[model samples]
Target: MPPETGLRIPQDNRFVLSNARVPTELVADPPPGATRDAEGALLLDLLVQNGRIAALFPAGMAPETACRVDLEGRHLWPAFIDMHTHLDCGHAIPRVRPDGTIHGGFSLTAEDWPRWTDEDLDLRMEFGIRCAHAHGVSALRSHVDSETLAYSQRHWRALDRLRAKWAGKVDLQGVTICAMEAWIGPEARALADLAADMGGILGGVTDTLDRGENGTYDALGQALDRLFALAGERELDVDLHVDQTEDLSAFTIPEIAKARLRSGFKGRVVLGHCVNLSLMPPEVIDRTLALAREADLAFVSMPTPMMYLMDRKPGRTPRWRGVTTANEIRAAGLPLAIGGDNCRDAWFAYGDHDMLDTLKQAIRVFQADEPLTGSLAMASRVPADLIGRPDLGRIGADLPANLVIFQARSLNVILARDQADRIVLKNGRQVTDPLPQHHELEAALGLLDTAS
Candidate 1:
């Protein structure tokens, strides 16, 4: 059947997606004798029903009674999963000053949190999630600040509401971001317990490591012990924000590995930032990567925000790049995923939950240009694995019908285009109007672009 001029998606979760140019590499465990053509494209049709992928058939072979939507030979892949983000805190307005440095960003966060009303929080979070969904992200793990007990609990309640609201459209996971001292206290424990009740992850920042980098790391190590203990007790995963600074010697990745080993943590351990880890000498970096691998630690790179925050000194140009050791970490065979950490927030202004934009920036910063360079996995495949959803982002029989159809033949074309044309589907139905904020969203995105 021919597609209509505008969105021709069916309201029911039953349809036949045809004329898709699926990549051979994205198909997981294809049937015997299945192969791609000379151009690495598999012209296939997907049969989706009851919110799941019923089967994969050859082009023009789907049942005639089912509603059909032609993909126009566009590339089809699994919808992206953003493994790390600060959704609850995403701001559409410019939060940081034009002359702001890293310290200024941090100060802005502390200053902004108290002023945010419940309605403002919900508005921003909803806008961010909607943007993510529109851009083909089906699942995302957002870190919410868990400072004071009351504040953290309120944010969790707000997220729960959003999660329930976006249930089938997007799977929203929350992580309680707390301070090191919180882990050792009752307030933090209550916060972690609440997070567990809400099916959220436990996380904290380890900035105290900067004070005792050369010493025994007694305080930070003890804090990790408490944090992991809470996680183990709550039966939740661990995600930490660590070493988000330009101090080259303030490395916490190694100590985190040691703490993981000491605690016998077998659950998923996700660490973000580690900017100082990027500034270390080659030998030290190798050693740290090895330790991290031994401890089974997965790294999340926030390139745009990290780049904006790192190595800023008044009246001086940045001498170092603000990126984690992506190449070295991948070389050590560790799981590495990249994320759009903050969106138009105080941390670093400007983002709209576009994973392709994130991937393009990462490709340039980390120089992962080819299939051999391991760039693709950082956004799609690796993030799915890190989020424990192996069934996502792969073409195969008997998977959820969540998928993305990019209007490009390959990644090169997709990245080169100024405006990306794409279709986002949940359960085989296209998302024509995902935003609830309406025109306010446009104004917000406009503000973000100007702020950037």
Candidate 2:
């Protein structure tokens, strides 16, 4: 489907790919051999109008619009859609422990609960948004803990404020990260109710049972019942943070998968992590893959955190090696995508909200020969398809004006770097550049302690 008429798209209808060879068509294995072609594989001119793709012609294309820019010697792809990024939203990252149970630089219990005030949330969110945009992320799914969701009548107002703040430039999705609080029964429902009111997907913690011992084995069933019922009543989308640990004992995933089956959820449901399967016995991996395919369940792997979070014991290879092999997962026939779960929140002092880094890590880890195309799909097509926005992921006539232009000549060489200097345009105008303002987010949070 084409974007709605009358939106801003770059009028730069002419450009060239010097020595670049676009993926033109690769077999897309959403479920094993289910492959498809993406025509016009290489050199082209990408035209934009009203923030959607207006025209794409070979090398030089004539334009009815007088504005056109040459993106010679650069690469252009669809704007990235990060399916997961915690940002500084939750008190979750920055953990002093592997389980993310601690607060900032020091002790137990973390930051003050009241620290999540409007200014705090807004400030953190803005910093995150700026970082994401700079990283070429045009759409994002970020979450604040359930504490914020329970108090959403007061807390989540930040999302509305944020929507107003960056309105036309970004597409945002907020979830009530309820794993820590799901077994609370009524309180959890209230969070779901709040999410329903706000109009977006409700993300659940379905893997808590086997995780930190704080969550019940049956807690998932209870939470899913409450959440699914409420979402059913309200028609909300479901995105579960599934199988978060290396413990093969975690049974919540199957429960949630069964729930999705019972609920008749097709594309509206998403599964975030199944890290255990990354190292699961081949038979187990095979069965799980089949289940996911049958469930129409989508996967979002946090490359940095998953690689760092699990067991590293010699005998623990099955679960701790890393949760996602982008290439393997794709070959498994599962719809997959990548997300930067950590924005240097403390627990994970690594990620930069840059998908490029995530892609590089995936290539190294997965040994993906076609890393660029793999990373681009993980950040674009897969996420877009998962979210019901296909028009925005491709570059062609009638697609959304959401596209990315990278300041690089080759994919392999570009991703080999630690960061990328790129431009993200929503409707035709550049809205973000991640590299130039890398420290902006950290500085904003008083993370550097500049603010009191």
Candidate with top TM-score is 1
Mark the 10 consecutive residues where model 2 has the least summed lDDT: 26-35
Model 1 lDDT per residue over 1-452, tens place: 22233446677667888877776656665544444655666778888898788888776666787888887676788788898999866763554443346666566777777755677677788888888988888889898888888888888988899999999888989999877888888686788889999889899888754465557677788889988888988778899998998775567787788999999877899999888887788889888888888999999999988888787777888887789888878889998899999877667677789887898899888877755345766877888888788888676788888887776765567778733457777777777764355357546444445444
Model 2 spans with C-alpha error above 4 angstroms: 1-22, 25-41, 63-67, 88-112, 180-184, 210-219, 312-320, 325-328, 370-375, 432-452
Q: In order, what lDDT does every prediction score? A: 0.78, 0.60
Q: How close is candidate 1 to the true structure, as a TM-score?
A: 0.90
Task: Tell me model 2's lDDT, rounded to 2 decimals.
Answer: 0.60
**TM-scores of all predicted structures:** 0.90, 0.80
Q: Local error of candidate 1 at 255, Å?
A: 0.8
lDDT of 1: 0.78
lDDT of 1 at 50: 84
Candidate 1 clash pair list: 78-393
For model 1, what is the error of residue 289's alpha carbon versus the real structure, in angstroms, after optimal superposition?
A: 1.2
By summed lDDT, the worst window of 10 consecutive residues in model 1 runs over 1-10
